[model samples]
Target: MASVRVEALTKRFGDRQVVNKVSFQVADGAFAVMLGPSGSGKTTLLRCIAGLELPDSGSVYIGDVLMDELSPRERDLSMVFQNYSLFPHMSVKANLAFPLVVRHRPRGEVEERVRRTAELLRIEQHLDKRPNQLSGGEQQRVSLGRAIIREPRAFLMDEPLSGLDAPLKLQMRAELKRVQRETKLTTIYVTHDQVEGMGLASVLGVMNEGELIQYDAPAEVYARPRNAFVAGFVGNPPASLLEAEVREENGNLELRGDGFTYRVGEDLARALKGNTDRVIIGVKPEGVKLVRAQRAPNDIDGVLDYTEDFGSTVIAHLRIGQGSISASIPPQEGIGLEAGARVGVRWDAEKLSFFDARSSERIV
Candidate 1:
């Protein structure tokens, strides 16, 4: 296993800069995921690392070796693509053994490695099946087995689980996690799915518009985002952002919007003191509570717009003035609420996040 590092990596297609001055490091034996939306330069960045596409500027290194001049085959890294990239005419065993055969390993060693890889991926039963005969999930296992048999310096995966159904994707993710743990291979995975990125990564790298937004542990990225984009993108249902003005009322700072006013604590006030009057307040869906009875000092009254039931928990969409915000609540607690129902939304001042409206950067 080896560490992978990219420094000031920039790639351009025609006049468009798809990857602009990107830099990050994946520790040896750690699973790192680069996550972003489509056309956000994630796959382009991965291809640059794999030597399939050359970067316009900067460098890629594996372990202590600079790999800028190396060919894809000479890079000692295995790339598992989204399509499974299996040989249509070859059986699972043949597919797994192809890498070793190309490297001109002894016949006995190739057979042994193929068998071990098939067993590890739980595809030993399907070793004789061709790609056409295998299910989507099974074919993906063969793809993974091929990569594993190479015993490459590192692994680069580009949305390897994108083709599977939801349940199958979940199962495959668990299997992939187990394999990575046992092999301890340095892995850089590219995907647009937040759930996949958050679930698989030991280190998470968030990307947007050809820039590296944040690089950190999944929990830290979700809890303490560096900017409004990271705060909005990393969460399920996303964090709700409301436009407000910072006003010093008596001794306390208050955020005043069209239909609501939220008082701020000293810590948050101190953080926002230097900012302009215009600011954005961010609150996660879980932080927004639906209060049925008496309104508190921080409560904001709104009309319940709609509800989405997800068995154990429910998402309540509320309309506060002209803006909309969502609240994640337990079904039991939100059972009495209905569309057009008058409701009060309240959250702790400590849970609120303050951001500069113009820059969209976090102030608190």
Candidate 2:
């Protein structure tokens, strides 16, 4: 296993900068996930690292060796594509052995690796079956086995589990994490699914437009988002954003918006150095609370819109002052708040995220 480093990598197609000066390092044996929406340049960045797409102006280093001029074959990287690119003409065993065979590995070594890879991916029972004969999940596992059997320097996976059903996605996420840890493979995976990325990544990167926005541990990216985009994009259901103006009313900081005023703590107030007048306030579902109250100094009034119950937790959707937001309500508080019933919304000050209204940068 070896670290994979990409230095100031950028790629463009004609006029559009698809991937813009991105730089990051994956430590040896680390599971790093690049997360973003489509057209955010995650796949382009991955392709650059894999030698599939040449970066306009940057370098890719596998271990200590520069690989800018190297071909895909010369790079010795295993890439598991989204489509499960397995050969229908070949059996699972043949597919797993293909990589080694192409490299002119000994027959004995090829057979041994095929068997072990099949076992590792739990596709041993399907060894004699062609890809078309197997289920989607089975074929995907075989596809992964083919990649794993190569034992390359690093594994680059582009949404390999996206085709699976919801339950299978859950199962494969566990399996993929286990395989990476058991083999200690340095892996980089790309996905648009925040839940999937959060589950599999030791290091999570959030990207937007053509730029890498924030790179950090998944927890840090969620709890301490570097900007509004990171805060809105990282969490499941994400953070709810609201427009407001910052003010120092009577020597105490406050966030005033439609029909309500929110007090800001001293710690958070100090984080704002200058230009603190206009700001956007963000609160996670878990931070916003549902209170049965008449409009108060800091309580925003709203009407219960709807709810989403997932057995373990309940999300209360409320309409507040021309805008709507969702809050994670305890089972006890979830009841009796039906649609059209007026309610009060309050936030935990420490949990609120304040961003500059103009730049959308985090202030606290």
Candidate 3:
């Protein structure tokens, strides 16, 4: 397995900059996932790394070699695309053996590698069937089998599980992780699904507007986001962002806004003292609590908007001022709170995140 690296990679189309000076490295034998919304240039970046797209600037490196002039075949990287891309007329065994066959490997060696690859992907039962005869999951496995048969230096997958049904996607996710671990393959996967990124990757890179926003372990990105966009983008329900202004009141830093005035402790005050006066108040769904009265400290009055039951938990949507907040509570705890009901919303002070309003970067 080989490490993959990109340095200040930039790509442009006509007048629009699609990938803007992006840079990151995937360690050897590491499972790295590039996650972002559509048109964020993740797939384009993967193509650049695969030598399929020439960058306008910057460099691509596999292991220790510069790969700018190398063709896709010369790079020795295998790509599993979203569409499966298996030959409809060819049987699974033939498809898996095609790479070695084209390279003029001995027929006996090709058969042996194909057999091993089929067993590794657990698709041995489907080896005699063509792509059209297989289930979606079976075809996905066959696609992976073709890549694994070549024993390439690294693997690139572009939303490989997106086409599968929800349950199949869940099943294939575990299957892919198991196959990767067994082979110890260095892999780069691109997807917009946060669940897939969190589930499969040893390292995760978040992108927005063609820029690499944050790259870290999935848990770290969730717990400590770099800015407001990341804070709002990485979580399930995401952190609620509300506008507020920092005001000095009797040696204290107070966040004052429509229908709310929150005071920060001395330690945070010292940190925000010289910074900007405006900030975006952020609260996670789990940090929110609903109350019948304004008895709790820091409680902000709000109107219940709706509730969603999830068996284990209920998410209560509340409207406080013009901003919305999602509070995760036990079903029993969320009982009686329905739309149009007035409730007091309180956020855990310790878990709150603050971002500069203008820069949208984390202040504390």
TM-score of each: 0.97, 0.97, 0.96
**Model 1: lDDT of residue 255:** 88
Q: How would you encode candidate 3's per-residue C-alpha lDDT over 1-364 as one tens digit per residue? A: 8998899999988888899999999999999998899999999989999999999999989997999999999999999899989989899899999989999999999989998999998988988999999999999999998987889999999999999999999999999999999998999999999888888999999999889999999898888888888888777788888889999988778988777887787877887887999998788889888878646666788898999998899999888877788888889988777798998887887778889999999888
Residue 296 miss distance in model 1 (angstroms): 0.5
Q: Which candidate, 1 or 2, would have the higher lDDT against the true structure?
A: 1
Error of 3 at 65 (Å): 0.9
TM-score ranking from best to worst? Answer: 1, 2, 3
User: How big is the RMSD of model 1?
Assistant: 1.3
Cand. 1 Cα-lDDT: 0.90
The lDDT ranking, best first, is 1, 3, 2
lDDT value, residue 64 of candidate 3:
79
Worst 10 residues of 2 by lDDT: 266-275
Residue ranges of candidate 3 with Cα displaced over 4 Å: none
The most accurate candidate by lDDT is 1
lDDT of each: 0.90, 0.88, 0.89
Runs with alpha carbons beyond 4 Å of true place in candidate 1 = none
Q: For residues 1-364, what per-residue lDDT tens digits would candidate 2 score against the true structure? A: 7999999999999989999999999999999999999989999999999999978999999998999999998888999989988888998888889989988999988988888888889988989988999888888888888898989999999999999999989988999999999999999999999999999999999999889998999999999888888888877688888888888889888778765677877787777635678888888889988778555577888888998887778888888777677899878788777889988888888788888989999877
